[model samples]
Target: MRTVTVLGAGSWGTALAIHAARRGRPTLLWTRTPEHQAAMAQERRNARYLPDFPFPEGLRTTDDLHQALDGAELVICGIPSHGMRAMMERVAQDFATRDAPAPMYLIAAKGIEVDTLSNMHQVLAQELPPSHRGRIAALGGPSFAAEVAKGLPTTVVVGSEDAHVGMSIQALLSGDGVRAYVTDDILGVELGGAFKNVIAMAAGIGDGAGLGDNARAGIITRGLAEISRLAISLGALPATLSGLAGLGDLVLTCTGGLSRNRRVGIALGQGKKLEEILAEMGMVAEGVKNTKSAYRLAQQQGVEMPLVSTMYAILYEGMAVREAVQALMGRALKAEREW
Candidate 1:
C-alpha cells in the first residue's frame, strides 16, 4: 500500500484521508492550523468539517508540512483554488531542499484560480520543478465528501498525461465504495470538475426561484453544451466532457443536497446577500469565484457561455436572478446542434 499524505483538512480532504486509511494505507492528513490538528488528533475526528466521521486507526493528523510530506508516496491536494498557488509554492520550497524522490500529486480541488485564470494542474506546473511535474494528476467525478466518508458507492476519474500514473492511482483508490477510472484527457477532467459548480449554481437559482423542473432540465442540458464548447476550445476531448467527470459530476452537483455551490445559488435566488450566505455556510463555495474566472476565460477564448456570463452578472454585478433568467429565455434561438 502507498503511504498517503492529504493536504487540507476540509470535508473533502478529511473524507479522502479516511478512505485511504480504511484501505489500510497509512495516511497523514495535514491542516494549516496547529489548533485544528491538535483537536482532530486528540478527538480522532474532524470536528470542524466532518463531525460525524471518525478517523480510522491508520490515519494521523499533522500541522507541519514537512512531517506530512515525509516518506509519502502519494500526496492528495484538497486545498481551495485561491489558496492552491501559495500552498504549492511552499511545497516547491520544501522539495528544493529535499534529496528524496517527490511524491505523486493528486489534485482534489475543483476550481480555476481567480487571479491567474489557471486550472489546478497549471498552477501545479507553474510551482513545481520540471522533474516533479510529471507526477501530477487530477481526481474528479461525482464523488461527494460526506457520502464517500460514509462508505457509500462512489465513482471517480483519475486523469494524467502519463497512463501509468493514472493506472497506479486508480488501483489504489478503487473498491471500498469508491471506483476509480482513468483518462488521458487531464485538461477535460479538470475543466469539467471546475465548471460544473457554476452550472450547479444556475440550477439552484432555478429551483430557489420556483421556476420548476422543466426550467432546471433545460439549464442542465444547455449548461453541458456551454461547458463542452469551452472545454473543447481549450483542447479538451469532447468525449471526456460527456463522461463521468463532465456530465456525471454536473448532474450530481446541480441536484444533490450536499452541493455548496448550489446552496449559494439557492440563497441568491431567495434574495439573500452573497456576503450573508457565505458567512453562514462557513465553507468555500468554489462556484462563486469560479464564475468570475470562467466568465473571463470564455470571453478570452471567444466561446459563447451565456450561463457563465449570467452567473457572473448575478454574483458580481448585482443583476436580478429573475431578470437574468428572463434574458436567458429571450436570447436568439439557434439550431440545437452547432455543427
Candidate 2:
C-alpha cells in the first residue's frame, strides 16, 4: 500500500488523512504545531477539528515535516493558499536532501495566491523542483470536511496536466463512499475552485441581508459568468467550468449551511466586521482571501468581474454591502450573452 502523508492538520487535512487511513493505507497526518500533533497522537482524534471521528489504525500524527515526508508515496497538501509557496519551499528542501524519488503531490487547497496571483498548480510549478513538477495534481469539488469525515457520499475531481498523474490520484482516493473523477483541465479546475468561494460569499451576503432566492439565483448565474470569462481568458476550457469544479462546487458552497466562506459573508451581511467574523470562526474562509487575489487577477487579465470587484471593495475598501448591491444592480444594461 502507498503511504500517504497529509500536510496541515486543519479540518480538511484531517478528513483526508482519515479517509486514506480508513481505506487501509498507512497515512501520516502532519501539522506544524507541536501541540496539535501531540493532541492528535494521544487522543487518536483531531479535537480541534473533527472530534467525533477517531483515527483509524493505519493513521499516525507528526509535527516534523521531514519525518512525514521520509517514506511518503503521496503527499496531500491541505495548507491554505497564502502559505502554499512557503510550504512547498520546505518540501522542496526536504526532497533535495534525500536521494529518494519525490512523492506525488495532491494539492487539496483552493484559492489563488495573493502575492503572485497564481493558482495552486502554478505556485507549485514555481516552487517544486522541475523533475517533481510533473507529479503535481489538484483535488477540487464540493466535498466538505465534516461530511467527508463521516464517510458520506461525495464526489470530487482530480486534475493534472498529465493524465497519468490525475489517474493515480483518482485511484488512490477513490473508495469509501467517495468517487473521484479525472480531468486534464487543471487551470479550469483551480480557477473554478478558487472563484466559487467568492461567489458563495455573495450568496451568503444576500441571504443574510434577507434577499430571497431570486436574488441568490441571479448572483450565482452572474458570478459563474464572471468566473467563466476570466477562466476562458486564461486558456481554460469552457466545458470544465460547467462541470464539477465549477458549477457543482459553486452551488454547493453558495447554499450549503456548512460553508465557512458563506457563513463569513452572512456575518458581514449582518453588519459584523470582517475581522470580528473571522475571529469568531477560527477557520480559513478562502473566499475572503480569494476575493482580493481574484479581483487583482481579473484586472491583470483585463476581465470585467463586477462581483469580484464589489467583494474586494466590501472586504478591503470598506464599501457597505448596500453600496455593493447598488453598484451591481445599477450596471449599464447589456446583453446577457456577450458573444
TM-score of each: 0.98, 0.98
List the global CA lDDT of all models: 0.93, 0.92
Task: Predict model 1's lDDT versus the native.
Answer: 0.93
Residue pairs with clashing backbones, model 1: none
Candidate 2 regions exceeding 4 Å error are: none
Q: How far out, in Å, is residue 104 in model 2?
A: 0.8
Question: Against the hidden true structure, what lDDT does model 2 obtain?
Answer: 0.92
Could you give candidate 2's per-residue lDDT for residues 1-339 as a string of tens digits?
A: 658999999999999999999988999999989999999999999999889999999999999998999888899999999999999999999989988776899999998999888899998989998889998888988999988989999999999988988998899889997999999999999999999999999999999998889999998999999999999999889988998999999999999999999999888889999999999999999999999989988898999999999999999999999989998899898888971
Query: What are the per-residue Cα lDDT tens digits for candidate 1 across 1-339?
Result: 557999999999999999999998999999999999999999999999999999999999999999888888999999998999999999999888888787899999999998888999999999987888998899989988999999999999999998988998998899789999999999999999999999999999998989999988988999999999999999999999999999999999999999999999888889999999999999999998989989999999999899999999998999998799889988898888961
On the 0 to 100 scale, the lDDT of residue 130 in model 1 is 84
